[model samples]
Structures are given as structure tokens and as C-alpha cells.
Target: MIFLDGIPISKWGLQIQQEHDHPAVPELRRKAMIIPGMDGEWDFGSESGPKPFNFPLGFIEYDKNEKQRRINEFVAFLLDPYGRPREMKLSFDYEQDKYYRVKIANGFTPRRIHGFAFFDLPLIASKPRKNFMVPSDEIVMESDIPILSDLLWDTGFSDRKITSPQSFEIINNGTVVILFSFQMEGSGDNVSFSANGKTMTFKNFANKSLEITDNYVVKVNGISDLTISNGIFLELLPGTNQITVSGSNLNLTISESLTYQYV
Candidate 1:
């Protein structure tokens, strides 16, 4: 069975196969070659950007009388305009709690079968070529994270603060770079953050709302600061990562959200 964006589309019972009669679903794969020749080709390259997922051909056999309904539903739910595919969360390996984010790459056509009908739809990995870990959307919500100062909090709760580590674990199972978004409002002489084994520091900052992401420029109080040295947008690796934030006379609250993916 296959689920599209958490909805099972194979109520009619579909069979994923290698070929017309191979009776096996071809393995879904992602392929890429080196990076940092900085020039081009033939060197130590990393996993290229998110690649497309080419699903092995699959057959969806439906009752002859219900052919029209099945075709309409599949097309309506999966395809957008101009043959462009829509991103869908497909669930095939339910036991592992993983879903592939994909869209139709080429197109699908139904061929008449023995008194029935069938079609083939291969998918393109929408963003990343990794299978997203489920519940699908997992979040880490931390409240009461101890801080050196409790400047921002409930009224009259400023004096009840401690100087404990602002640490959390990022549970990313994918072998790819996971973009992380970090935003916080605070002030200090020097603000420092340590993730995994990398650290970033900001000096002479006060009363500012700082936002940082792996894909864009760092913004301080609504102003983009491209010259901020030691401003490293940290990417999370596979497994549990140790993250800590510290600074002299710094009191702040940090909110972070990272989407998990796996190959």
C-alpha cells in the first residue's frame, strides 16, 4: 500500500514491481559524485544536492468499471498543472516510520489489462533524496531552559534563573546536511554557541533579535549582517549532537526546529 501525504492511495490494492512481470519492487536509490574540485568533476565530491527519486515501475490494477474513478482520483491527488508533480509523503515501510518525499518525475499512463487497467508512476525526490523520519513532523520543544539571566520571561520571574547549559540533542538519522534555523533575543559582551564540535561567537552585541539559518544571511534585529565573523550556520549530522550556548553576561531563550531526513 502507498500513502500520499499520509493518505493511503492504494485502497484498490497496487503492486510495486520491477518490470511487467518481475514481481519485485526495484530498489529506490540516490546517486551523486564528489565536490570541491571547486573546478569541476573528477575529485573528492560530497553528496550532491537533493536528487530525484526514480521509483521502479508500479502497477495499479483497478476494476474495469471503476477505471474512470481511479484514474481521476490518482491524477487529481498527485499531479498539478503542466505535468508538474506535487510533493507527497509516501508510506511503504510503515514499520520503520519513514516516508519518502517525492513527486511524479515524468508522467504516468494507464494501459488496459486483462479485463482491468494498470498504470506506472515513478517519483522524483522533491527536495532531498532522503526518507524523512516519521511521525513525519517531529519537533523538540524546550521550556525553562536554564540561563545565566532570566531577562525575558513571565512578569516578576527574572530573579529565578540559573547558569546551566542550554543544551539539546538533534536526532537526525540522515547522512546529509540538515539545515537548522536558530533565532534568539538577548544581550551580552560576547555570545558563543557550540554544536557538535564547532563553535561560533559574536562580540559586542546587545539588545538584539538575532536570526540565523543555513541557507540565508544572518539578520540582527531585522538587519542583515553579512560581515559578522564567526557566524557559522551549523548543520546537524546523524545521531545525537551536543549543543551548548554561553556568553559573558548573556541571558536569552533560544528556539530551534530541524527537519530529520535519512538515505
Candidate 2:
């Protein structure tokens, strides 16, 4: 079974026959050149290309009269009113927890064969990756926590707060490095975030929320702030990433969504 944008195609009288393309691996986008004096090609690097998935769908309606209507509905769902393909969430029965961001590769037309209407549904994922289908698990760190010195003072709170300079570890179960974002707010003298050997410090800021986007864009609250240095965006490797945040009376929220770029 296949689901598009949380709606099953079977609802529109469409059903996959026997098999479909696995589409687990994406094509590599590698740049290489062979020099006249070199015996092998020079290796630059490679990125991922779009991934394609094809579904051989057959329309089966008990009443022959309803077949055309159902087919039209199916097409309407895949295309917008402007007759253009839209991005959709595509998932399968076997891996319900993951989904692909996809669009129709090309226009589809059903051909009548063996008393059934059949068509090839081609989907192309521009991201060339499958992501977790569920909502992001938000990890929030509040300022009410005891400071690190409290460990000796024996003044830990009843809540989940740990310390003033919060230190934590985030594990990326995926096989590739993935970018993450965080938002922090506090009235303080200085605040610093460290991860993956990179540190970003904001000093003398008050009553403003600082955000670092997954794309490495920094913003004061919702508006983009260009003053932040590049490469301050946080990232998690395949295994564990040690994250340290130091500030006075600050609250931080980190998004824990993980994306698997490869197997």
C-alpha cells in the first residue's frame, strides 16, 4: 500500500499490483576529470541526485461506471487546480515511520488493459532522502535549573532542570551528518553554544530570542540577523554530539528531528 500526503491511494480505487521500485539508493552527483598525464580521473567529490520511485497502479472498481470518476479523482489529488504537480509526502506500508518528499515525475495517463485501467505513477524526490514521518521531538532546557556548582551545594530542583551551563548529548541514529537548529532566550550578560568543536557566543543581549536555523541562518527572534558569523549552525554526526550551552538565566530549545541521507 502507498500513501500520498497522508491519504492512501487505495481510497481512490487505485491499487499496486505485485511489485515496485525500492528507490532506497539515490543517484550520485560526482565531478571528476581525467588529465592527459594522469592515469586515473581526479576525484573531486560527489553529492546525491534526485531519487525516483515508480508504482504500477491498477484501478479496480466493482462497477465499471465508477472507474473514470475514480481515476479523475486520483489525478486531481496528484495535481493542483493549476495543472501542476505539488510536493507531497510519500510513504509505504513496510516503512510507515518514514516518508519521502516527492512530486509526480511527469503527467500520467491510464491505459485500459485486461479489463482494468492501469498506469505507471512516477514520483521524484528532489531531496533524494526519506525522513521521519512523525513530528519533531522538541527538547527544551529551561533557566530555572540549578547551576553546575549546585552539584556540590545539593540544591537540585524537583523539575527536570539540570544546571546553568547546560551540557547534553544528542545521538543521531542515522548514517549521515544532519543539521539541527536551536532557539534560546534569556536576559543575560553572555550566552555561548558549543557543538562539534564550534562555538558561538552572544554577549550583552537582553530580552531577545536568538535562533540558529538548520541552514546556518541566524536570527534574532523571527527576523534574520546577518551579524552572526557563518558556520555557527549546529550539526550532529552519525553517532553522538556533545552540546554545551553556557549562560545566565537562559532557556534553550533544540529540535531533535533526525534525517537519514543514506542507508
Candidate 3:
């Protein structure tokens, strides 16, 4: 089974021959120099960039009226402004999960097959496909100002949640960067999160929650002493990341997806 953004290839009118992972190197270089006193060439250290991934997607069938055709949906979903740079995951058993931030490179020709639509697609990823086992947990806050000092691992808190200041901590065990999400109810429309000595906050609308993911707010409710400034975000590094939350007295609920890499 193959899924690009949770849209199954079988559902998207793609015929599967076999799942494949091809080796692709983004950058490879060598440094060599020769001098009169030196040998033919003084070999220097070579630089290698991170490996990327590619996928050859082939379609088996398509019908405009019979089958819920995907010729239009596939292109719209993959080519959308927000969906283009999204991280796409491909998993076999939800164990060996691979994630790739990618864009369609070439060969998305839609040809007809069996009086239906057929096509082949090739996608080039910006970085190597990442396969990692990630565990997620969630917890609800009891008080408006919850103390999460005892929290050792990443956990998710309530959504449309508490109104007041927030603070917490999490020790990331992953070797790479891990992103987190925070959903809340706002009063002043200004919000942001601070962690790991870095922060990504918003100050444009001063009376709403930082629900930028949805980019929708029916009510405005938030107030904080922290002078509204610019935007900052949290990126967890391997080890400990200290966090301090401040915003428009917003109801903040957080979900931390702990990232882990195979050693």
C-alpha cells in the first residue's frame, strides 16, 4: 500500500507494481591539489550532502463518471500552495514510516487506459526520506496556569483550552528536529510559543488565538503583558528544550510529537 498525503495510490487510480526506494545523492564533491614538492595530487577531504528520495508513481485506471476520477483532484492536491511543501509520509505497517518534503518534478502525463485515464509521475524530494518511529501522547491541563515542570516527555494538552499564561518542558530524544503544535482559544488575537531559546509568535491580530493552522477564529479573547512583537516558533533539538508560553490570555493546548531516529 502507498499513500501520498493519506490519499492511497490505489484510490488515486495508480497501479502498483512494487514499492521501491531509489538511491539519490543531492551533493557529492572531492578536493585535490598538487604542488612541486607534493605527490601527483594531495588528496583533500571530500564533502557530501544529505541524500534525497524519488518516487515513480504510475496510474492504472481513471474514469470521469464511473470511478471517482483523480485526474483533477490529484493535480489540485499536489500542486496547491500549502500542499506543495508539505511532508508526505509513506508507510508499510506504520512501523517503517518514511517522510519526505517534496515537490512534483516531472512526468505527470495523463494518458488514457482502458478508456480511462493513466499516467506516470516522478517526484524529487529536497532531502532524504526519513524513516522514524514516533510516539505521541496527550494530557489535559487542570488549571488555567498549569505547571508542567514534572513533565519529562512530550505530551499533548487540551485544545480550545485554558486562558492565562502557560509554561512547560520536554526532553526530545530524537537526533533531528521535531515540530510541535499548539491550539488555543484567543481573546486579544495575539499568540505565540517560546522554547529552546527560540520562539515563533504572532502579533498581527491582537484579539485571536494563534490558530494559524486553521486560520479561522469565531471569537476573539486574549490578553497578555508580554509586549507583542514578531513571530517565533519552537524546533526541538536532541536533548532538553525549555519552554515558556505567553500570549493573549489564550486557551492553549499543546501536542508534542516526539521524534526518534533508528540508531
Query: Which candidate number would show the highest lDDT if scored against the true structure?
Result: 2
Name model 3 segments beyond 4 Å from true.
11-19, 22-98, 108-120, 126-156, 159-167, 171-175, 179-181, 184-194, 199-207, 212-227, 245-263
Tell me, what's the RMSD of every candidate?
Answer: 9.3, 7.8, 9.5
Deviation in angstroms for 73 in model 2? 0.7
Candidate 1, number of clashes: 3
Q: Please report, as a residue range, the 10-residue window in candidate 3 with the lowest summed lDDT.
A: 211-220
Q: If both were scored by lDDT, which would come out higher, candidate 1 or candidate 2? A: 2
Give the local distance difference test score of model 1.
Answer: 0.56
On residues 47-120, what C-alpha lDDT tens digit does candidate 1 reach at each position?
A: 43444443433344446656667677667777777655777876654323556677777776777776556566
RMSD score of candidate 3 (Å):
9.5
lDDT for position 95 in model 2: 70
The backbone clash count of each candidate, in order, is: 3, 0, 21
Could you give me the TM-score of model 1 versus the true structure? Answer: 0.61
What tens-digit string does per-residue lDDT give for candidate 3 at 1-263? 55676567776666644666545345557888877887688889776544444444555443555533466666766676765633455433243344444556654666656755544555555454353423433322442212422233334343425466667666655555665544444343455567767766665453344332211222224433233445344666667766676766464444443434321
lDDT of 3 at 54: 48
lDDT of 2 by residue, 119-163 (tens): 899999988767754323321243332233111111111122423
lDDT of 2 at 255: 38
TM-score of each: 0.61, 0.79, 0.46
